[model samples]
Target: MQKSLSSLMIALAFASATAPQAHAASNEDVVKRHFASLVAGPTPKTSELQMFLTMMPKGGDLHHHYSGAIYAEQYLEWVDKQGFCVNKTDFRINTAAGAKSASCVSGKDLVADNAAYRALLQKWSTADFYNHSSGKQLPPDQTFFDTFGYFNDVASTNGSEGLQTLKKRAIAENLSYIETIYEIAPITPDGDFDKLAAEGFDNARLNAALEALVPKLEASQAFQQGIQNYLAHLQKASAGVDDEQFTMRYQPFVLRFLPPSMVFSQMLASFKLAKTSPQIVGVNIVGQESLNVSMRDYSLHMQMFKFLKAKYPDVKMALHAGELALGVVPPEGLKFHIQEAVNVAGANRIGHGIDIAHESNALAIMKTMRERRIPVEVNLTSNEFILGVKGPAHPLDLYRKYGVPFVISTDDAGVTRHNLSNEYVLFATRYKTDYAEVKKLSYDSIRYSFLADADKKRLLQQLDSRFSKFEADIARALLPAK
Candidate 1:
């Protein structure tokens, strides 16, 4: 509905610019002048900027999370459809036995009671965290991650349905592509590897351990079945999602906090899957980077990534590194994440990177990102909410100063209660960016995407057309009558 209205507005602008449609240059000049006017001051017109960015052709969301992109309301609807019951106290998916008891409520019945429904929404998401913070609630970061747990039961169940919602929403906002962290790669545990990892194996020993473990995992029925199940899941989730206008691709990730063997095995499976599946463009490692488990295994995770990259040679990674802040972890922990993610993991892209300022030799890291043309996936809303890093405190300016490329992204739009457009608004307003730089961010999204060379070129050309049309429409709307 909104998208149709926007198109109509753009058409009206086109008409207002000129009837003959021959004054393309004049219309473009008018649009550029108008945009410059909006962005002239130390403080850009934020509300107008929001409207402008909403219609801009954002190339892709490379750091998106499939489950996190889903809103809580949609999950509630699924709960009702799937006949799942919600626990009244914790807002969890209740068991059949528990559902029959007074402790649980049917989704249908819960909706009738408005208070319960609203409370459930808050608990299930970051919705009105302030209103309910008087009660027992987790910290914002904890709350954000916890939302997934509350809905994980039904999260993957309606993959195609969830994907459809995301697609419609993306198109509504004029976004052309999304490469989402769709799901985790399945794993079969390795007892031997686990023992060695806990005892702390050096790099060589770790490699040797993997050498021994690879065949064991390959021969194991459980591991092979995991791969098949993962592929089947992807097939079902992405069925009929693509068309001429928009595209969606998957990034099967491994969680950082898992056992060393589990992480390696999952990474292996995902990298292996990438070798075959065109839909699965890349792999990522994700989780709260500050957790004890995550911090301890950080180096090993990069090594695992490096090993997989060498073996597959074609698999790409956009690792979640430097996602921490000063107080989130010890100083030592901050020093090497982004560095290793780039130098060791051979990450094609970096996600979050909010802690770049605190990283040791931060200039060097930025230099590497710049030199290699590796773009950082900057998630404004996610960083602010999760790490309390925003405005001048953010490392965005540093990256810019050092010439490190970046792409604005939505790390967890549903959890953060913002869209990719809002992210652009935040970034532009915060940095006081002019229209030209803002447009570059849009183009950078496609350029840094893990899509095939052909796909990237195709999308870039589409962006060119989109920007031209958008600028013309805006020009017409801003033109004055004689």
Candidate 2:
């Protein structure tokens, strides 16, 4: 009887999943048929197309980093605004003496104001990221990664303004929400930190130095109050943000290369903020995981979380695990990242689980993720940019084949020079997914999002109702006049 009841319950769940569409079947059928009719056509009505795009309910980007979301051009403009000089040959912004050096490339001199130079940088960075050009140099990983240094000055300086810019872009792309990764610290500038440490500092002394810098950090207090400041700033930027517009939340991430205790302490601080700061939803560990220290302490980091979780279980975690591709790490390191994230670190979401196919007990790992419903954050552009994985090489198909929940995300939209819309289009074109499946994927985003239960359900219902109407409208346009 219990087995029979379990079967009945599973059937009921499946039924409920389809029932809403069943009630709205006419509209869905109309869309499916209309799209089918277009297999060999010059496209449908423009207004209808616009509405469809508008109603393409994108779920929240659960794994976005703020610094990676800004447009490269915006950074350049900010650099120019700051009256900084850009190297004529390399385009590196020359900051004030003793300031952090801006990174750029070495090349023949190009007129700084030349439209071609601007376009070249745009092409090199995120602005012209979508343009496919035959003659453009295919960048090495360092060349690509180094772009951040060129713009780091503006990236750090623009802070909230930069976030606002990305937020607007998300809204334009039809994304409904984003959980952006950003750095928050009470620490002094790197130079000051080094200076203090050189002056015979220990951890306690470093803490005192940090406390001294607190006023400096807090002076911007708007940006310096750590996660709380970030929350206030985001709220201010998003104050007029509507339900139809994309919403954003903050995830305070710490560089992993820091001392374990320091990272742990910073992480604890983030968790404390998460408990009270609505905008600050959680914490993430990032940066150069392939480094020896990171790997050496991987288990220790997870154990740290296990300890933190005991104290603050509600503080959410979405981690960067298994982001490495073949040759990126030792063979032994490949098998356990996703597993450790799921089993030990208590990560609710996994970022760039690209090595899923390579892990030991790979199928079991995938099954665990499926059973747990912990979605892998899929950053198609980043995977292609960083790991050389695209199309069939990507795990998109495998994730689907195994029934592992996955959501498309932009890991570093600004850095990779892509957007949420591009990600959708990539999934559609690459996977040969029809519009219904695309719509379903979009809905799945909200359904599986880490939003509060009440909020998630409400957004799911809204997406369903909105999607149904959108399909109906498209169908009405497609049909012959009665």
Candidate 3:
């Protein structure tokens, strides 16, 4: 039988009440007890706990996407400034007159049309998706992914400016660090390589073909220059920012729906870039996992990682595995994704391991993750919006039950219309998570990050100091009035 939310809350309360009496309560424990009381009340929604969580210092967002993190309104401002046109019919952005095509509205006409502008806002974001009266409701998954395509032009053109915007937003929310997944190299496929990739998935043949391309890629001036340009853009984006207040890192990602040869080449480039660049910390594969090409090449992609990881053992990997739900794919499909990602690809972290219950020998998989200490980047809002998986059905409690570590994040925050604070609110209120658990999650974000050991230690120390101050403030706020 599945556990209900009320039962989960009762279990947590029982655990807290049963603590050993000989030990004195730490500041974190005191804060947790107080917060637990508020949550236990009839209406925790109106309590000050929301304010407390919003102001709390969150350590880092480990699964962010740079382009999808920006608001649609911001993208529109960039569009207007750059003289880009919006297609009134489909609400797509066009870069120039020739690029507008026959179906798109002219830039001047789109600017004058208020109705079209409003439609663009709704179509480009989660603005009107909940309003049944607006006649603009779309399936949540479609709305979430479609936003990226509509705003791709603006996001692609304004890399540095978008970084500045994201930095300012992160500071406002008290976020200490961000590891954003951005595309550094363009996907321009080699014809000879495409023919080889299409030849089928034989490990030996794939290995031989990939080995031949390494020399040519390394020797190409264009490939070398692309890496240089990518690094320069990041440096330009972070020019005057103080690392103490906020820090940023990049993970160059490959689109999973591409042909195997293209995916392998991108992974090769990413690993090479990580070796040479200070800003680029890791590489990840991104896209809808349920796509035909993605599902077909999933195991092949893991093999690719196995091959490359042996070659560049130091390059970090965080694969997006098991983001599917029951209706989205076959039962057999769900059984091995998370397993392969961990056992085959050797992923350091799993993004959106929501289908854990559906995996074959699910308990064994959880046990392996716990023993290995592989963390999951939990994005509550994104999972609910995209997969219709939330509440008691979510694996958040299951991960806790089995001792699997996880850190809360806002995956595509802007697209999902959520922030880090909102994620904390959902987690704490829904799971009845106490303040001590919240603090641990914050610390774990830094602990499980892709940073070097020295940097991780420094960040953890900083977090400890911040939590001490926060606990003191909480004590004063909760005191009885004179």
TM-score of 2: 0.75
How does candidate 2 score on lDDT?
0.69
Identify the candidate with maximal lDDT: 1
- Model 2 spans with C-alpha error above 4 angstroms: 1-25, 34-55, 97-112, 115-139, 184-239, 242-244
Q: How many residue pairs clash (N, CA or C atoms closer than 3 angstroms) in each of the candidate models, in the order given?
A: 0, 1, 0
- Return the TM-score for each candidate structure: 0.93, 0.75, 0.88
Q: Rank the candidates by lDDT, best first.
A: 1, 3, 2
Candidate 3 C-alpha lDDT tens digits along 1-482: 25698898989889878977557666666677777876775567634667878778899999999888998778877876687767778888878655555557555566567777667767777766665345557778887888888988888677778887888898787788888997645443567877876677587887787788777777777767777777777677667654777778889889998876678778888898889887788999999898888888899899889889989999999889999999898778898999998998889999999999999978988899999999899999899888999989999899999999999998998887778988888887778677778888888999989987877898888888888988877876776656
Cα error of candidate 1 at position 389, Å: 0.1
lDDT, candidate 3, equals: 0.82
Instruction: Write model 2 residue lDDT over 1-482, tens digit each, in one string.
Output: 99999999999999998776556548678877654443324443444444455556676777787777776667666765665655644556677754333333222223344664665475446444445444654554544566666766666675657766776777675577777787553322335644554465444564566556445443543433555655565566556544544556677786666765456556666676678777677778887677777777676667667667767888888889888778878888888888888887898889988888888888898898899898888988888877778889888899889989888788888777667766775665566556677776787777666677777777777766767666767767777777
**Cα lDDT for residue 440, model 2?**
69
Candidate 1 or 2, higher lDDT?
A: 1
lDDT of 1 by residue, 1-482 (tens): 99999999999998887787574567657766777777777778878988988988899999999899998888888887777788877789864643545667777777778888888877777888766566577788998888888988988889999999999999999999999999889888888899998898888998899889899999999999999999998898888889988999999989889899899999989988898799999999999899999998899989988887988988888999999888888788889999999999999999989888878888888888899998889998888888889999998988888999999999989876789999988987788677778888899899999999999999999999999999878877887654
Q: Quote the positional error of residue 39 for candidate 3 in Å.
A: 1.8
Better of 2 and 3 by lDDT: 3
